[model samples]
Target: MRPDPHFLRGGQGGFGLVAAMFVIIVVAGAVAAMARMSETQNATSRMAIQQARAYQAARAGIEWGIHRALAGESCSDTFTLEGFAVAVQCDTGAAVSLPEEGRSPRFVSLRASAQYASPGSPDHVYRQLSAVVEKDD
Candidate 1:
């Protein structure tokens, strides 16, 4: 007695179901990985922005220090701007008199620093700027 060909084909239907389930699992995993990558990119972009802002704040503080030194005022202060806190400090060295020169000039060194922190993140960003300012005696 020969077996029916239809019965042999019926057993193959389970193989199709297993193959479909494997495909679905692979697609779901790929989607999850993409979501995680997107989230990481967004976080990195936010940190870059915060770092740039902190650098700008530090540069502003350095400019303020230079201005004060040029104006013959005290060049130390602390201030806050746009969620960043800045501190500026300037130090002036002894003036050097040039030989055969009608007028002598002095140079001053200035250092400024700024710090910023995001509300929900534990990371803190810091930037520092330095400059040499010349003043005429």
Candidate 2:
């Protein structure tokens, strides 16, 4: 009539299996979280690149418009550059009267906007640029 020590040890058998399963679940969760973070980081990087490209396209459009305005050419058009669509608008303002030097100058306003995106995609980027140029009249 003795209480067997082996009986208590038998209950400990399932403990190892439970601990192993818990470790496996924790590792899996960590791996999944890391994967998600990497994806997000990649997406952010891509968006940043797209934004830079759009900005460059808009800046180019603004320069083009300014050049055209200074050359006395009308500026109003849309074009594509580096995978982005750029729109430009430019106009010459009233001439400045300088009586002392007997010279007149005109101010040309130029604006450009660029956009890049795929249809129905959330990763869209846009940029705008404005400039003013002075021309002798």
TM-score of each: 0.85, 0.90
The C-alpha RMSD in Å for every predicted model, in order, reads 3.1, 2.5
* Runs in model 1 lying further than 4 Å from the true structure: 1-9, 118-122
Q: What is the lDDT of residue 25 in candidate 2?
A: 100
Query: Model 2 — which ten-residue stretch has the worst lDDT?
Result: 117-126
Tell me the deviation in Å of residue 131 in model 2.
0.6
Put down candidate 2 lDDT per residue, 1-137, tens digits, no spaces.
99898886886767889999999999999999999999999999998988888888999999889878877788889998877889999878899999999999999888999988864678788889999988997
**To one decimal, what is the Cα RMSD in angstroms of model 1 from the true structure?**
3.1
**Candidate 2 RMSD to the correct structure:** 2.5
Candidate 1 residue-wise lDDT, 29-121, digit = tens: 999999999999998898888899999999999999998999999999999989898999988888888878866788999999899874456
Q: After superposition, how far is residue 70 of candidate 1 from its true place, in Å?
A: 0.4
Q: What residue runs in model 2 are displaced by over 4 Å at the alpha carbon? A: 1-9, 118-120
